[model samples]
Target: MLYKVVSHMLEQEAVVEAQNSTQAKRKACRLWGVSPSDEWHGISTMQARKLTEKERRVAAVAIKHRNICLHTDEGGSTVSIRNTATALSVINQLIGTDTGYFG
Candidate 1:
């Protein structure tokens, strides 16, 4: 009976995972500059690793949103803005990368 309960829980978790993946795929599809749905849908284990790398890259760049700079002007070029890094990260996430540095 305990085994059956554990098995049922595992099955339910799998179902939830599938649903989450589907939702993620749909979201990725809606995003114009994101990976194609085909790439995310029915993803293989290798592809899952790739996706994880992408997510890490995104997270790394997202750190820039908290950046604060001291400049004569608030919106001056002297102020460091990491927008480029963020964009690069997003692009890398959209496309698979060979280097695992993103991880």
Candidate 2:
């Protein structure tokens, strides 16, 4: 997707294609200055590590909402999540998501 990279100067922006928004931010940063934050989308960047094979599998995609569960191969059980943002943040940590303050 083509993500818009806007600097503090709003008027100073650039467009670039990337696998995800974070990648876009990185590319924008390379252009000179671009600060990336989860607040970019009014969201916070989630940090997560693999708990098992299934967690690994879950990390492969983006989960938009919370209150969802995902199963892994190593475990014969499922894990229930509470918050959507936290879960998504975890998933995002594995795969980049644009948590910027934008829509």
Candidate 3:
């Protein structure tokens, strides 16, 4: 499928440029003749490895509340779980990490 081809190109770019995941994605776009304005809806496992620092920060913040919930007003346990779920959803939306591993 298209995903497999793009993924292979991305990996090749990574090996060629010695770049990380994010860079490889950009490279793949170029290889596929995709413009920067193009909207990408999925993130392969490679992309997850390349997540930008900003995304990583957001994901971390999203997950942090879960730990906080363990100590503070544990009464809001549902709220904490909700936030984490929302965070996971956002991450999945932005980058397809195939979090099925969590299950």
Candidate 4:
């Protein structure tokens, strides 16, 4: 199963595959180059929780579709428009021209 592990001490988080929260914490600590024992000392400040089915599915879809791009150089670095009509409406708005069909 997939777990979302957050390290308050390091101000970082990761999604890891583990059997349980304990294992998730351990794996997260290893990935972050921290000691798992530090949790006892209140140093690691790690938390682990399982991802829900919906969250998992959404994540998978987002990764597969790449609907949003952050880098300008990557081409299509914009939110994807689903259909031709919607795309035309957006283009018209950007150009300050309202086509009657979309308006």
Candidate 5:
């Protein structure tokens, strides 16, 4: 959710993200210098948008990648694919983009 810190009297606004509505509102109150009774009201929650299939898949790949270095490397995280671009291509195909890149 997006927490909006809105000051109607001062015409000021700030935005923040929190796990739940209450947390967002509280943060917004502090940010906009409002005490829940001030004429300058602050704190409004907006619903967050869900990620699409392509965006989710792209994010998943961007988050983690295998250590595809050739030869015996000292540190290796995962030994799945051989290269990052190759893996991205394969993931794109599975996600229906088929751009051969992180598209």
Candidate 6:
């Protein structure tokens, strides 16, 4: 599962995959290059919470859309689609549902 960890002292946040909050905090600290001693000393006040299902879905859609936008043509050039309808169609296909906004 994905968890969001926030460091109140550093005013920073990170998303990590962990089994629980303790693991999430450890992963986030490692990602930020923070030492365990610093965390214990309250140098980087950290809190970890799991991401909701909706948030996870949104994140997945965003990643997939980014990959779609970065797709390249046969000539090694990036293909850009400027049509809103086409974009909506792609999004609907990725999420496996029609959101009704583009209907």
Q: Per-residue alpha-carbon lDDT of model 5 for 1-103, expressed as tens digits?
A: 3333344555544334456655655655765566644443534332223334655554355435543222224543333655554554444233332333222
Q: For candidate 4, what is the total of clashing residue pairs?
A: 0
| Tens-place lDDT digits, model 6, residues 35-102 | 75684523247887777677566545544454343322433323344453344334434332343221
lDDT over C-alpha atoms for residue 33 of model 5: 60
Q: Model 6 — TM-score against the truth?
A: 0.55
Ranked candidates, highest TM-score first: 6, 4, 5, 2, 1, 3
CA lDDT scores, all candidates in order:
0.31, 0.41, 0.39, 0.56, 0.44, 0.56
Candidate 1 on 1-103: residue-level lDDT in tens? 0000011211211111123454533333333233342433222211211235444444344444533222233352222336744443343342333333332
- Global fold similarity of model 3 (TM-score): 0.27
Worst 10 residues of 1 by lDDT: 1-10
Measured against the true structure, the TM-scores of the candidates, in listed sequence, are: 0.28, 0.30, 0.27, 0.54, 0.31, 0.55
Distance from true position, residue 74, model 1, in Å?
31
Superior candidate under TM-score, 1 versus 2: 2
Residue 60 lDDT in candidate 3:
69
Identify the runs in model 4 with alpha carbons over 4 angstroms from their true place.
39-44, 61-103
TM-score computed on alpha carbons, candidate 2: 0.30
Q: Which ten residues in a row have the lowest lDDT in candidate 6?
A: 94-103
User: RMSD in angstroms, all models?
Assistant: 14.2, 13.1, 13.2, 13.7, 13.5, 11.6
**Candidate 1 ranges with C-alpha deviation above 4 Å:** 1-19, 32-61, 64-99
Question: What does candidate 5 score in Cα RMSD to the true structure?
Answer: 13.5
Q: For model 4, what is the C-alpha lDDT against the true structure? A: 0.56
Better of 1 and 6 by TM-score: 6
In candidate 4, position 86 carries an lDDT of 46
3 or 5, which is superior by lDDT? 5
Worst-scoring 10-residue span by lDDT in model 3: 1-10
Which segments of model 3 are wrong by more than 4 Å? 1-49, 67-86, 94-103
